[model samples]
Target chain A: MAALDRSLLVVIVDVNPAMWTAEAAGEHAPFVPIIRHLCMFINAFRALDGGNRLAIVACHAGKPTMLIRADEELDRSLHTVLDTALVLVLLATPDDPAQYNSVMNCIFAAQRAAIMIDCFAIRTSSTFMQQAAHMTGGVYVEPTAQQELGLAQLLITLALPDRACRALLRQPKAHDVDFRAACFLTNQLLDRAYVCSVCLSIFHHGDIIECPACRSRFPPPPRLARKRAKRAVAPAHGGPVIGGAHAAAAGAGSSAPRPAL
Target chain B: MADGRDARDARVSPLITFLVGQRRGRLGRLYANPWTCEAVVRALPPVARHYALRLVALGDTGDGATFAPATLEGWSLAHDAHQAALQWLLDLSIIERAEQPGALRLNAAFREQCGSLLCGLRPPAPKPPNKHTPSADELDAHAAAQWDALLYCVIHPSEWSDSTGYDMPAALLEPAGLIAARRVRARADGDDDDGDGGDDVDDDDGAETIEVWAMSKRGATFVLQDLSAQAWHILQVYIGDDERKLAFLLELAHMDFGHGYELRDEHRPLIAELHHLGIVHVRDAAKSKSFYPTRLAAAIVSSGDISPGGSARGRAIVESNLRVYVYTSSRAWTAILALFLRLRTLLPNAVVASITRERIQRAMREHGLSAEAIIAFLTRNAHEQVRRRPAEERDKALTVFEQIRLWERELERFTAKEAYYLSDFDTLALFDAELAHALASGTHLWHRREPGNARLCKLVLHEREDVIAEARARIKEFKRSAGLA
Candidate 1:
């Protein structure tokens, strides 16, 4: 029998109560209408084929609230799971940097597995989401022109089709993506940053004292000993002596070590 | 996925399949009713259902009635993925090519009815289910008794013993091709198995021939089919060529199961036949005010997909030790289990049985059930709990199925078949021509180019009269084509 392209749509609905309930202050679209559109879109996806499977993750307050399957184990499963998986993120809130690594991990996992990751940024356009959609060969749509009015139609036309038909689809023009990592401690996007060698944590500050995520000290302990040696030499020679740690730290931060050859 | 490969699915109701074969006018008329639309929607393939659900809602009278086949609604799906679904819709007349080349139009009758349905207009609501209504179990027993007694007439023909129950449903059995008349010689001993269905008749003079009704080959296979298929097969026979009756049956499939509905005048005769077949239950078949669709009726239609072997309902759990727990109370189901299962303990609702090698061999040798059928029966009926179990535990359960197959292989040597052997060929050229004809026609079971002499060859053809007739013509045609006149 011919193998069917059985789509596995993972719809991560932004049910963040913070975003949905922000009516007076923030201009977020009504929750009910978005949910209704989502439901119709889900129905449309199911209509596409009989064997298609879907997982809806309701992210309440930017945390996976309920329904089915843990998101934590998804990256591991991506290797074994269906190739036709499409993770559609419907983001309403601003970027939650705490979940950046996880989101990025999932995006890369999806990319590696050849799974498409479509992002519909409702309220705020996320740089990570844009990059994710761009990398994974999926459409990134931030339909900010008319919030509620053509949401359903936009979703069906743009994101409903899989990667094969998507080539022909008139997708929402993707803006420039910031292929930059955010600091775990500062939560600020950075072009260049220091990464802890042990924990792989990003640090943008001058000299890394300690890793914020894994709490592993980033060579500052060795720097203190090097400072003591410099101080001991300074007293003997009464002259300025540069610490070896400074030269070592600069060369050590980058991913790979230089070969002598 | 054509999940129906295991079971002859009621997915496209045998009724719908029949209607599809009829004239477009009759099929369109059938689609006129909303209930028929509802039934068709249930039976539609998932992809096709998806399009119908959207398009039918858009099928209003005025503007935007037609949809472009190449646009978002149709074209949004992957190109190769749903072409089959689109074609299926066209075949069923749910959608058709409009005047323009690329445009598609929903069937007018189907759309109108489906539109009314989408607008929430429905047939009279089933009266709120009564608290005092007979329990589902009780109804099962009632249906079982009525249905089994009818089938019992087939299995243990009442003529042989004093176990007289329902009259020989020869009207049903004969017409349905479940049983056929065969004239047998009434010997003094009368110990033949075929002698039981005593439709014995004295032919004019001294007792020369006795016409006995025996089970047909179709009837033998019918027994192996699960309940849903058996029910549909009967309906297929019952609702032969009657478009109006078939329409009513589709409408009936839409009705609530277990709830009694008022039987209209038009449906009275149909209800009588259905009641006799234990599909629908009426207080009195003579004058019925209301008829309740039995579980059998519900099983045939309401169940999403009905396979020939069985529904993969996962009603039974197979343990590592080969013990089986079947969660059903139906006597008919138990009767099937008795074929291969070593029934250990029979509870009120569950049957605890063992998959013994002896029982498996017996079921194979006596009942002619294949190892694959037995394994499929177990797999399809695998308990939900078994699916939920850990991989190793599930694998353990799987090994039990493997054992049954292994045992069957161990015991198997040669199987018998009924076929006609043709021998006597003038030359090798003639023999090769006939062999090619039979093989191409699928009637050639076995053939030998030369049994003894190079001139003569042995060939076996299927014994079925229709197949033999067609094979003979094909063989002659091949001879003529080869210029071996």
Candidate 2:
């Protein structure tokens, strides 16, 4: 039976320096105060449903990291409960934002050492905190630097119930998610490019005589001699022949089938 | 745990081994906590609890389950722990497992029995209850109220002392040290002089409380008063051997109880009480999970139609019924059944008895049985049959209207009997004592009392014990007030 009473709520507190810096400049609650308040709110939620879950996400520079993931396992597979926080000490460095994965790895390793517990992903997902909470049927809360939304209020009201009983009420829904794909070619997000009709492969400019995806060849046309033969057919025929030449030309034209991958 | 296991192993034998192996079959899942154990414990009736507790205690280690089939009772420990515990522990987050294998461990902080997590364990502030105990009079009044509640379940408040069986609940007697020894007395055929006319009567001895097993004036009053019409009828059929209540329950399983009756956890107790009453029998089905009703349970519903037969005919029914059903046929059931006439039946097996309309009408007329009382008798018997389905079933099949009709015709022959009247009391003290005495005698009724015009409290009695007892108490109080005693 679907347990109608239990629920899990995961609050991913994004502590990215670049993101929070912008927010800190705004006329809103400072990031530190928000984090402190969010922790207390999480405690309140745990009191409501003592078994409800909470996770924190910190994004520094552009790398998203986890500050606190309740460690009940010891594996990378969302199942491991390790008291590990992925904190990036090098957030102050002006490194390329693309080095985010490396920063995340360091943060995860540091958090693991602090707890001295193994990490297992048996029940949790791959993302810094969102995926872990998602696997366990918990709510995922990730506040970005761009919005000065009332995240604390949202946490209190929305993340109260455990996952089992949360189905009846309307909750925050993610509709237009960022589905931009990272290119295998340059490892950068791609917008538009030549796609292989047969294999659905995408590519930049290549030889016109050959298809890059399937390596199929296309024969070039003999231009001058073909035009001279057309002139010969027009003189040999009368008005019917002029029209016959057009018919013959029309008959000669044919389209090839598109190639399969 | 090991010491307990060794003791259990010492008692093991070949037949016992076979029984334990058959009972255990297999144990599945592990329950390591008291929270889990409590769920399984509550589902069991007291008898099952007695055995199950012994079984579990003999083998259970206070940790996650370790199935040691050979060590304890020679049975496999393959029972599902969560099922036994009813999943309450899962709700508490004290134990986490999955319906299937390979589920990840959700992280939870482990708290010890330390000060950080203790919520409600403050030492309660001392109170002066021990220092200022209630006075003797107050204690007596409090004890009376508590005793009344327990006793009230057996006999209705108005008919408390009038029950013929006079069997007080064990709870009441336990405190009073009035429990009768469990010995069957030697019976004298014709030599027993049962009347007040007997030579050299030993009546002044402790005989005041030692009423005869089957018949005594106070005991008969109590037994009769204890008879709700339906229960009385159920006893009648069992005595008649018409049908065992168990068989009736099996047939009733096919019938419907109106209004989607959802049998809840609480209803189990009420059903168990009926079983305890010896009105029905439930047996474990062969190699199955649930219990099946036996043949004796079948006639429970029909028994409800019986009116309270008077003492003469009722006694015969009780004796005959007692002879047929050896187990669970209580003295109270037999006494209640003795009210009808010519109850004997020459049956080869089970009960081959028949009750006539004339006998029923005669019983009503002689015993002053009310129409409501007669109907109540049949309905209570019918309920055992009806309970086969869970109480929460949509349609309850037993018809109350049918039983009521049976009594209406039977009651026409009865003549009104006058009860004693006591009124114009000068003091509250007089009125209260008289009321209590009247209630104790099991004959008090609000219907006989009128207000303002009469200035009198009236009580109707087929017997005047209620009034007589009350009058005696009032006279004593009156003398005490006048300083004559």
Worst 10-residue lDDT window for candidate 1 chain A reads A232-241
Worst 10 residues of 2 chain B by lDDT: B310-319
lDDT per residue for candidate 1 within B1-485, as digits (tens), equals 55222222235545456556767676788888877777676566544555676565344324556778775344433443356557667778888788988888889888878766644554555555565455556566567666665554454342422232334446566677776676666767764353222434445566667666665555545565656666766776677777667777766655666687777887876776676666677776557566777656645544343422222256888888989899877665676677578889999989999999988877676546777777767776777787788888778776887898888887776677899988767567667877887888788898888745745678898887987777577667866887877
Give all candidates' CA lDDT scores.
Answer: 0.64, 0.33
**Candidate 2 lDDT over residue span B329-444, tens digit each:** 23234324434323344333223223445544554554445445544443344333343546544133223234334755656546666656556555555566556766776776
lDDT of each residue in A1-261, candidate 2, tens digit only: 001222333333334455455656884444464454355445443333222344555545456676667545322433233222221111222224244335334434533443111111111122322222322333444444432244333444344432322343334543222222222234343332323334333332211445554665434434543343232222212222123333333333421212323
Q: C-alpha displacement of B306 in model 1, angstroms?
A: 6.3
Runs in model 2 lying further than 4 Å from the true structure:
A1-13, A17-29, A53-149, A159-166, A172-179, A187-261, B1-485
Q: What proportion of the true contacts does each candidate reproduce?
A: 0.00, 0.00
Provide the global lDDT of candidate 1 against the true structure: 0.64
Model 2 interface RMSD over true interface Cα atoms:
22.6
